[model samples]
Target: MEKERKVFGISWNVFLLGLVSFLNDMSSEMIAPIVPAYLTEVLKVGKLAGGSIMGLIESASSLFKVVFGYFSDRFRKRKVFVFTGYALSTVAKGALAFTQGWLDFLALRLLDRTGKGIRTAPRDALIAESSNGKTGKSFGFHRMMDTLGAVAGPLIAVLLLGLLSYLPKEVLYRRIFLISAVPGIISLIIIALFVKDRGGEVKKKIAGVSSLRSRSLQLFLAVVALGTLGRYSYAFTLWKAEELGYTVLQGSAFYALFNLIYALSAYPIGVYSDRVSKKALIGAGFLLSALASICFAFAQSLPLLVVAFILYGLHMAVMDTVPRAYMAELAGEGEKGTVIGAYHTVVGVFAFPASLIAGYLWNTYSLTYSFLFASAMAFLAFILLQFD
Candidate 1:
């Protein structure tokens, strides 16, 4: 495998695509850390509805990613889908400036995620194709760039809000949304100019029912679904910060910190996964994540909560890079995009219900209970992987 596979190397396409993701994540995270606050405080959507909305958008993206990726595989075209998806996200962010109600917000969220769904698999496919055989390093580099953007977006948001805003609360958020468009434009240009697709002749036929049949992939998807149930979101971390009386600026700062750590760890963890068992790393990630969630739940002071958030970032670094690499490893060569899309779709299918359950538990019971529930789900995912 080592001789046949390139090691510690990547191509120009990979670097360019990573820049595209970097810019896109910068645009996306600019708004993400603040969306819950905007929905809850401005739109008055309530916690459960907000969680449901967030989860629904995510699930919707996964659905589209799967569908588009399947078609892209059949058609052997990836660039158009990638371009169109980023365009859609850019439009969505533009619309956020004028959104006045929950309906508009919902529409914008769906549209934004629609772009995500369309682009994710193709973008990933492009990276994998570029690397040929070093799947771990390829995906890891992409994730690192993506998380670097994640770190920058919040910092940008914080800076803009701090320096340029003296307006009312609503206006301030609107201005932040407007500024998000800058990264979107940057991403569009970077992708259009630099990203390339070299995957050979596409089959041009829909996968028959048999193409979707992979028992190992199915088992892994189930495990991932269970893991996602325990993984509510980092948004909740911001929410908890607010509950602890952290200002929005403070929350954004923490958000940036988390992403910083997450960005730094992505490549190392990916490389490490190649050295060890991917499943073992995933289990370790989940277990550490559970501990972080539990700690977040019981934390009463700002310092402890900050610690939990930092650890949560580490958890994400492991989760985001390794599992996808594992999935790629599990997939047959030509079937990578299909497998990636299917994996995301399956986990996303579970995300909808998981968010609903977590929201209900958070609202009806307590936030602590919600964290505990998330922790339990992580443990379950860890346990299920033993058989794999």
Candidate 2:
């Protein structure tokens, strides 16, 4: 009898990439939970300005995702862009300690997200190429580790705050920002030392990203764009928690809960996606997103907010992992990077107005209107995907 090759169902390189992501998220998440408060309280920025900053950051990320993704495919280079991206982010994270105003915050924040946009599609292409038939399994495993880091990042923040309670808040915040560089540096070393340039495996298609001309990609990107149009910044979630009377520490706890459930469920659902239909999983994700919107819309208490967070994590697991895998499966040879980049860029472009719209709704109508709008969009997306 032949022995089956089974070890997390990913290449050794993919596994190392996952480790890199895990460390990076750990560094990033350490900053994420504190961003809203840091901007509004310490920097004296308003909530609307904060939301706008997030919107610009999202836009920056999208812009870079398409730009670098195409070039990576055009030049048939992956590791170099991936390395530069992470290195830039490491510098940006460390630079946070020196930010003087909202302008500084905006510039540094955009720089950080730019790095993300550059690395994401190429890294995902690398994983998709590596995952083969077990696309979900590979993505699930990566996200599981990424989410695990997310779980730790906020908790680490809370712990650091508690331990350093005696220090001035400004000093403490700067210290945490400085500390984020450690994990980021570790990630850079791993990528530099271990991750190889596997771009040679991909055949260079015609010179540009004409691969997006395919009808299937057109439909997929449209549906996802429409579906994700309402999915706004998760910073809104933390904002909502604060509105509901949870302290910053408690909000971190809620975020941690969300990541915990996400980490635990991501891999199992990813493995299950391999056995079932990817479209079905994607559709289910849309509906779950709708459901979570409703829950967040109606949630009145912290405990109820916890329920919303849990559903939110589940929605991410079902939707986020499957669609990319599906798209990767759909791509022609050597086109994964471009297609994935275009797909992400499209969804992100549509999502550009999300936080702005959410902020507008919150300021003009109410949070309820924002949530309802999101729920309606998600439901519509799910219905459309079902038709596909």
Which candidate number would show the highest lDDT if scored against the true structure?
2
* Residue pairs clashing, model 1: none
Pick out the ten consecutive residues of candidate 2 with the lowest summed lDDT. 1-10
Q: Write the per-residue lDDT of candidate 1 for residues 1-388, one digit (tens) a residue.
A: 1222223366777777788889989998898777888999899998889878877876778788778776667667788889999999998987898999999898998899889889887777666666666777777888998999999999988887788668888888998898888889988887788666665543334445343587766777778888888777566788788888888889999999999989999888877777888888889998978888898899899778878888898998988888778766775556667777787777677778777777888889878888899889988888998886
Candidate 2: stretches off by over 4 Å = 1-7, 203-211
Model 1 — TM-score against the truth?
A: 0.94
Compose the digit string of candidate 2's lDDT tens values, residues 257-359: 8888888988888888889998888888989888888888999976678889998999887776887778778776677787888878887787768777877
lDDT of each: 0.81, 0.83
Per-candidate Cα RMSD to the true structure, in Å, reads 2.9, 2.5
> In lDDT terms, how accurate is model 2?
0.83
lDDT of 1: 0.81
